[model samples]
Target: MTLSTEGIEPISNAVPKVWHIETVLIMETCPMVLAGIRHLLAQPYFQIKHWLEVSMVVDIPHIIKRHEADLVIMELSGEGESILDGLKIINQYLANWPSASLIVCTALTDDRLLKQLVAMGFMAFISSRIRYRP
Candidate 1:
């Protein structure tokens, strides 16, 4: 069975109302990748805040308090452990932004992992890899 977006529900918290136009929090270890994504999003349309270190995500609750983003995107670029750690970090802050969306971007094409991510309240899992046909 395919998981539909309509079936996925947003994580709800009893936070105050803040009418924002999509505040984004990007968690990535690569500076270049972070810069590229930041450049893509318009400043007026989105409030983009980034967490640079995957290791530093242990202090995610405090970081979320400072950044306060509605959309949290994680780049799964490292090894299996890092990917697992990233998911853990994202889950911790899910309560920080109840209505926020969490999305994972990776080159991995594992169907089992994709199913797990969806079940974990990850609204989207985007493949970052690009293939060119000759």
Candidate 2:
């Protein structure tokens, strides 16, 4: 008995061009971070058709659906109970949308919160610095 593998074609090693079609929905409460991310992802590789700095929950579902976001970048500011509260909000939202990659940028990178955030399932956790552009 002989097995035939007639329909196999080798892929090109010439770096098969990747056309980025996935849209990213940036949700930041801070204006500066929103602007920063917008500027950073303005390269040819990415297409950001829609971006929003959400100050309220009412607008989140609409933006997420409208943008067809592959990635949801969130920036959280402040500390103490405030930060935890924000984390709760983020965690809830992320729980709802497991498909969306959540990258969190926060002003406070303390060990405890970092661990907690990691456990909560953040794709990337970046320190909040004005010079820090991810």
Candidate 3:
């Protein structure tokens, strides 16, 4: 059966009081990551409001605010682009949206890098090698 938006019920007494949909912005440069997310959250319960591939993290805040996104799934590859740059972007975002949840969908294999990302305000991290949805 096809999932219909009309059949989806809103969670009762949700905090925001706006009956606003919780949207996820898939921000990954990798095609596989994008495809995986598209598959993972394709269930009726989750909504993929938008998918964007940004060249810089500086552009993230505007997109988040404009979309009023509930979560962000980003690709964190410590190669090519320095992790420091990514953290800087997160720091800037925290200045405006401390409560926004950002889940890093990275290929990093080191536990230290994972911990660092968590400290940098990523709500959660899922290895790119994993395909299961939370």
> Quick one: best TM-score, which candidate?
3
Worst 10 residues of 3 by lDDT: 12-21
Model 1 agreement with the true structure over 1-89: per-residue lDDT tens digits: 97676855556434423325435666655566666666766445444444333424444456677766667667654433456666676
> What TM-score do all the candidates reach, one by one?
0.59, 0.64, 0.66
Residue range 1-134, candidate 2, lDDT tens digits: 98785775546434444435366655566677766777777766565565455654344566776655677676653312356556766777688877667888766658898888888887998665566468
In candidate 1, clashing pairs total: 0
State in Å the error of residue 1, model 2: 51
Give the alpha carbon lDDT tens digit for every residue of 29-80 in model 3: 6777778777777756554555455644556667876876677777653326
User: What order do candidates take by TM-score, descending?
Assistant: 3, 2, 1
Q: Is candidate 2 or candidate 3 better by TM-score?
A: 3
Collision count for each candidate, in order: 0, 0, 0
User: Over 4 Å off in model 1, which ranges?
Assistant: 1-22, 30-32, 43-59, 77-81, 130-134
Q: Which scores greater on TM-score, model 1 or model 2? A: 2
C-alpha local distance difference test of each model: 0.61, 0.65, 0.67
Find the 10 residues in a row with the least total lDDT in model 2.
Answer: 12-21
Overall local distance difference test of candidate 1: 0.61
